[model samples]
Target: MAATHDVTNQVPDLVGHDVAHDPALLESLHRHGAGWAEAELRELGVHAGSAKAQERGRLANENPPNLHTHDRVGHRIDEVEFHPSWHELMEVAVSRGLHAAPWRDERPGAHLARASKLHVWGQVEAGHTCPISMTYAAVPALRHSPELAATYESLLASTRYDPGLGVPAGKSGLIAGMSMTEKQGGSDVRANTTEATPTDSGGHVLVGHKWFTSAPMSDMFLTLAQAPGGLSCFLVPRVLPDGNRNPIRLQRLKNKLGNRSNASAEIEYDGALGWLVGDEGRGVRTIIEMVNNTRLDCVIGAASGMRAGAVRAVHHARHRAAFGSALVDQPLMRNVLADLVVESDAATTIAMRLAAAADRVDDPQEQALRRLGLAVTKYWVCKRGPAHAAEAVECLGGNGYVEDSGMPRVYREAPLLGIWEGSGNVAALDVLRAMAKQPDSVEALFTEIAPVEGADSRLDRAVSEVKKELADFTDAEYRARRVVERMALVLQGAGLVRHGHEAVADAFCASRLEGDGGLAFGTLPVGTDTESIIERARARF
Candidate 1:
């Protein structure tokens, strides 16, 4: 037989499969992009022409944008653009987006929220963050009409679009979404004291104050309130479909921690007529579909921040020399840089897969798989990215602490990722919930894995541990941890799906999920944090 064991047959096609979807590996779509940014920007008319225009347009980098200067804070905040080609257009939009009508200097605008969290988060970082939040929270509920859904997606698909096309071309030329937060309520959604009642005029009256309404200037909001059958989600508009005042109101701007370019508002509404979304009692569940997508946004932003910081820190380490040679020359620095590069690359892969799943999954079991995958991947990447970025900053010594270096911005951003959407704990709980609902999905998930050759061995060990854990539902917390831990395995299986390496969903069952060491984005804690910590300590410490 000529002892012919061809290397090609024996060795798997590497590029044929995108290993990036490994649980810890973030999807590669974003990493593979940057070229698409300008196209996307220009497509939305975000930047009209010239690279200099794009680089120069970021007003937040210098002047920073603001949102608190308007009387009617919620209906439609102004929009601003810093890219020179569209600077004038950006300024007007920014002003309108922030409700700062009639263009103004960026100083005062940023001042209200400069150092606060809102400023950091307000500006659009990744194109997907703002659009996703709006699409899920406001747009779906906007027209609730198929016409509107298509309109919403079209506008968002490309950031730089003519406000004239699709819904963006609304004569008023405005964009917005509903943001729901009250001063008193956190998880106790039922405690929302905001009242929406039926009026004699065949319309509902909205009365109450919302503590934190993101994108306050939104044209429409799927406002939630205390209605007849408990909490209800109602679609309220700035301008009714007829372009009349829908009675939407804005209290003031929130001036949050980060995301400065975007406005966070507090609003009060009186008689804001809105249609019920879904059924009356199903408000929480109905809106959850929207929130779930936003949660995914939080993950993308957090992961992107990690990548930005990593790239910068690594670039510096590679280029800037100290102590006889470049920082890249030092063993410790080399290790740190390598770790960052790998983590960033991996996080990108799985994040994209998570995004893909969120958009596509239809099966109830597959849906549950999607849910667990997003929850665990998000929790893991957000938590680990920060630690990695902060350490990368430490590698910068002192410059990273300063604002100019940009590492501080990203490091600061890392915390919000975990805190927003849902905490790691909440996501872990969701993982458990999903796992119980779809046990087979859980079993099928852990069946695939492939990594850096020898790496398969570790996945085998981890997966065996997962199978043993999933086999028993005796402990709720243990189940939760197992649910999240399987993120690694799900990621690997998903990689197969991404690469077309497998035809059936579980075709890659023969391989184990592989990853580099250090648990960047898939560590699952058993039970609640308090109990889990004590349990782990007793086991090893």
Candidate 2:
């Protein structure tokens, strides 16, 4: 080969490393009482980091899902065809119990363990996790109707990844999707105009168009419609009990910016039969349970992306040289890489803590903490995802912008998490709503942070500022974003101070809480431990 064509300066492809060997992830897993799951987590990590799994993720996204509105004979078959890699990813996720398995398990930290697994495995592919999260979230809402829960809960929790459209009874396992958003009402679901008229058989026929229905190929979906009593929640099956396709018609698949591996479609429910999940007029109340669970996954998804981006950036810096030295050894580059790692570590810490709260369902204080904490954390972490991914991509310079580097996919996927559950405004306002209605939740949040009080003066000041912000609701709506951002920082800081690595906690407190740094990623304070932070974020083979 000519000297000009040589690849001497090229960085090695990052593979064969354990994606789950992350220090922050491991610490959170053990701290949350899920130490028993470490072995399996590592196994999944190894698989996630393997070249085969990475290629699968790439192929799934590159191929994307194609919507078949009609068959060869022109039969109205609203089916979505996906690449085999998509199914493979889905199978691994299901077998790992990253879906509804926690609801079935009686273990102490089942939810936490599941969350940790999701965080680890999600690095392989994020689009498939959309359906997995819906399936997991669907169980909580289905429990509103004991009959429906009895029939499908076990199957949803089953590790078997049974695909295709079939009756719930005939299927060995089930996957679920959610159809809520309409063109008229995005976040304001109460404005939904979909009508659900009652039939004598105790079921309702739905007639409406869903603007955004993700995972359209799933066997069933939990939807909302206007019923006799008022707006209500209902379960709509793709194939009814008689083994015939329902009236769900896929209009077209959305040409989205990212998450192309999963098919999101605009569908028409032409007399689709649906069974009521909860009491009439209680649609929002029932579906919110499912929303809350998926929201937790949103945080997990963002954290997963952050960790992936950070690792890739660090890997590139360590191998590639610049200015007659390795990029990792450069001062400014170290600050940038270390800052990325700190942000990722903080996000992972809080996500695991929220999962821990999810496990303690019976504890009033924990539930209260979750009520308030989840909203603020979701708002801030997801909002930071796009910027973080952008910076991580920048760390790779031109290599990151190219498709082959895999950083572009991370950048594309980051914004979806923030937009999926709720947009930034909606999430921030929810924090205020929880504080207004559930005042005890505020106390629970403070109590959760109390253990780490005085550990870091910056964190202490931030907590005090949060209290001041909460004390006045006069302009709460206007200052919702500002208030929620500070609350999120304080929560993350507290978690780090309580359990995170010393260097991480110090960097986070100094830059994020104390405002000692500039707005960009490479602006950590002078004394920040860049070396230790970058080492923690490096991918381990």
Error of 1 at 8 (Å): 50
TM-score per prediction, in order, is 0.68, 0.99
Model 2 weakest 10-residue run by lDDT? 1-10
lDDT of 1 by residue, 1-541 (tens): 5866654212111111111112222113332222222222223222222233323333444444444333465535333222232334333334223222101213221211111111112222432135334543343343344554554433332333233112233633344465566789755566789887976764567888887666554555776887877788776766665555655555555555655445566777866776666667677777776667666666666656665555456556655678777676665565555445445545554555555443333445445556666777767777676686687688677867876565665665677677666677777887777676766556435432333223344434555666676677777685575556566544644454444212212212222243433343212222212221111111000
TM-score of 1: 0.68
User: How well is each residue in 1-541 modelled by candidate 2, as lDDT tens digits?
Assistant: 5577656889999999999999988998888899888998999999999999999999999999988888899888888899999999999999999998898998888999999999999998899999999999999999999999999999999999999978987899999999999999999999999999999999999999999999999989999999989999999999999998899999999999999899999999999999999999999999999999999999999999999999999999999999899999999999999999999999999999999999999999999999999999999999999999999999999999999999999999999999988999999999989998999999999998999987888999999988988888888899999999999999999999999999999999888887556889988899888999999988888
Identify the leading candidate in terms of TM-score: 2
284 in model 1: Cα distance from truth in Å? 1.5
Output the lDDT of residue 361, model 2: 90
Per-candidate RMSD, Å: 14.4, 0.9
